[model samples]
Target: MNSAEFRAVFRYIQALLIITQASLVLTDHREMLPPSPADINWLMHEWTPTVVRETNYSHRAIIPARNSQTRAAIAKVTTCDASAALTAQFFTEVEPAVRWLRSIYVV
Candidate 1:
């Protein structure tokens, strides 16, 4: 196959790997009857970027140790060239969830 085709296949495989790993992590965390502090912390800090090829959107969720830290990290990363759009989505959609998780866990 050509370079473009190979790249597309590689990206698809990468996306699938990311989704699978994220799902496993989420499921393992949920299986704990009462999630430990470490689990909560892991959930907040573990993030993977999945590029949605159909829409050309990259999606990621940041689980911060603190709400303010989340905001600051997002602010910092959003301005950088590599992750600007993903960071924007984090600010718009995922920020609230991150804050809520921080408040609930309060660690």
Candidate 2:
């Protein structure tokens, strides 16, 4: 997707994040190109912080590693997660990923 398309999607995700106490960002950039530095920076500076601050509980991502390109994008998001508390991790499947995210809430 192009920058504008990326921004629009991110905005929608960010808005959903803002209204929820805890949430998941399901980013499967399957056929799409890996995000640009501008996209990564937008997540770092804008999207992540906004979501982290908005959500009262944990926020996580389930970005399946469909390819090396997707893995790289997950890595960037994972790094950003360290500071934002929006934990982004890659998985090959959905079930285990969602299970892990739910496990985070258990006391």
Candidate 3:
């Protein structure tokens, strides 16, 4: 998606979080194609920091990897960019993600 579309979706999620007083953002990226560079740049450099400054949102991205190399790469990228309030992680399964969100008391 383009920047406008991405921003619209993000804003929708923010509005939903504000209305429900929620803190967890569960993004299911299973079976989806890899993100474009623009998307990655916006999310890691822009959206994440914005969320960190504006809210206590913990983002859990469920991204199924095809192999160990992919998993390692995903882990490296996510862990390197994560923050205290923005607990970004890529989970291969939904159960573990649910458990983590619960552990954080944000589910």
Candidate 4:
């Protein structure tokens, strides 16, 4: 996705968080594409921290992680980057990811 689209997604997520009053679980089933430098910069410098600051929990499951070491590393880095703002984790399977998210909601 382009930078603008990425920004829009953050906005959408923010809105969803407000409306649902719930934690987020983002699962991507598609093959990974390296984000543009601009997109990465925006995510690191702006979106990741700002949007997540008020968030209590947000998890991202990379369904393709089992096949990609690069993706697994990316997931780890993303969690670290947002660690101060919220709880974030990555999983290779959706079921476990959902279970983790559910557990957080109950806590």
Reference-based TM-score of each model: 0.25, 0.72, 0.64, 0.67
- State which candidate, 2 or 3, has the greater lDDT: 2
On a 0 to 1 TM-score scale, where does candidate 2 land against the true structure?
A: 0.72
Point out where model 4 deviates above 4 Å: 58-81
* 7-92 per-residue lDDT for model 2 (tens digits): 89878776666666346555555556677888888877777777667665354545555577756865676677534565556666
Q: Supply the global lDDT for candidate 1.
A: 0.36
Tens-place lDDT digits, model 4, residues 1-107: 66677668767877777677666656563465555566656666666676667654455544553335436545544755664555556566778877876766664
How does candidate 2 score on lDDT?
A: 0.66
Judged by lDDT relative to the true structure, which candidate is superior, 1 or 2?
2
| Residues 50-75 of candidate 3: C-alpha lDDT, one tens digit per residue | 76667656665555666554444344
Candidate achieving the largest lDDT: 2
Candidate 1 residue 71 Cα shift, in angstroms, is 2.3
Give the clashing residue pairs of candidate 3, or none. Answer: none
* Per-residue lDDT of 72 in model 2: 82
For model 2 the local lDDT of residue 46 reads 74
Residue 62, model 2: Cα distance from true site in angstroms: 2.3
